[model samples]
Target: MEITFLGTGAATALPLPFCNCPLCCKARTSGGKDIRKRSSMAVNDDLLVDLGPDTASAAYLYGFPLEQVQYCLQTHSHSDHFDPAHLITRLPEYASAGVVPMKVCGSSLTLKHMSEGVFREDEGTDMLSPEGMQKLSIQIHQAFPYSTFSAGRYRITTLPCGHDPGDGSMVYCIQDGNSTLLYATDTTSFSQEIWDFLISYEFHFTAVVMDHTYGSGINGEGHLNQDQFIEQLRIMRKNGIAGEQTLVFATHISHEGNSTHSDMEREHAAHGYAPAYDGLSIRI
Candidate 1:
């Protein structure tokens, strides 16, 4: 499996537009990996996680074949994650040519919120309706927690994210051939139920891209800080879910207490995981 991080920043992205804090100022001075877009990822050029506001721009900048994307797994309907403006462009009225039909999978509430976003953008385009979905060249598949389903050649299992309870946010376990990935973001620590499910399912991951929304010692509700992130990794390792070869990466970063990308990489490298930056790609 080929994984590409289109963007790796948290909800507000790195370097708030109007703020000039130390981290933000340093990010401005140190361009390269410090520059980040909203959180999003692409798998093997075919599947996308989170159609965020910067998805198109990030893909274009990184030379990813965005046109080949056939499936999208939405974690939630947060504006930073699911931008209806991008989805609206698939409508024939936009003169978008040769658009591939997209299959979007998410919790029912998430899907409903996304549809409402589309309605807000296009003025009454109800993406929940069959006619509306056909016009947009998209299919909405409601994914329930703990259920596995197939999308094209990949098998996906939905896992609840203890983030936005109202939106029914979810993480994902995606498998393609012999490679398996755990895409966990916009989440706090896993619940006991989730741990039991993972144990019972005998899931061993090839790679793990997990949430690190806050930096060390920083408290952020509905997100993981460095300490919490490491604890989760410890549990995964103890349970045999993440073996020695598992490529672990921290994503959905923010400028809260987080330092520059290089600094973070150096700090986290000893913890069995590294911070992912925009355009970073790996093969498992």
Candidate 2:
């Protein structure tokens, strides 16, 4: 399986455009890996996670054939996570009929926001002509707490992720045969049940894409502070959630959680993991 890191920054991405915050300033001074887009990933040229604003750039940089994606897995309705406007571009010019109806799986909130705000044309769709607004072959699946489903060769299991409560959010357990990967983002520490699930399932992991949003914040509610995140990693190891070859990655960096990309990598190195930057690719 091939996992492509499209973007790995937090909601606002790395350097928040016009800001002089210490992190942003340092990012400007130290360009390259320090630069981050939004949070998203492309899996095996078929499935994807989140559809952020920078999809075009990410695809271009990684040489992804945008029309080739057959499934899209969403985590929530955050503008940074699921941008329908950008997704709709796949309807016409960007993709022909062969690419129109790819399945989109996510929570009810994630699906509802896209259907009502986008597919239904609830309002403001004048720009997309009838041809551009062709009804897509989108399949919305329920990604509630601990729901599992399958599509073709992959098995998907949604786990609880602490981020939004009213709308809810999820982390994905994606597997193909012996290889399983935990796609965790827009999350803090796992809930007790989720922690138990990780312990109960002794599958060896190809990788763990984690949410490192709070960096060093005090228990920021629904978000993981650095200390707690490290503790959880320790537990994951103790419970056989990872093997000696399992790759642990930290992602979703916030402006407040800012540091030079390398500096951040060094911090996670202490936990035996590495930080994610835009365009990094992982194969498992």
Best-fitting candidate, scored by lDDT:
1
**TM-scores, each model vs. reference:** 0.99, 0.89
Candidate 1, residue 206: Cα displacement in angstroms equals: 0.5
Tens digits of per-residue lDDT for model 1 on 1-284?
99999999999998889888999998888888998899999999899999999999999998888788899999999988999999999888899999898899999999989998999999968898999988988888999999999999999999998999899999999999789999999999999999999999999999999999999999999999999999999999999999999999999999998899888988999998999999998888
Give a tens-digit lDDT track for model 2, residues 95-121.
546654667787877666666556543
lDDT of each: 0.93, 0.76
- List runs of model 1 lying over 4 Å from the truth: none
Residue 133 error, candidate 2, Å: 10
RMSD of each: 0.7, 3.3
| Model 1 CA lDDT for position 108 | 95
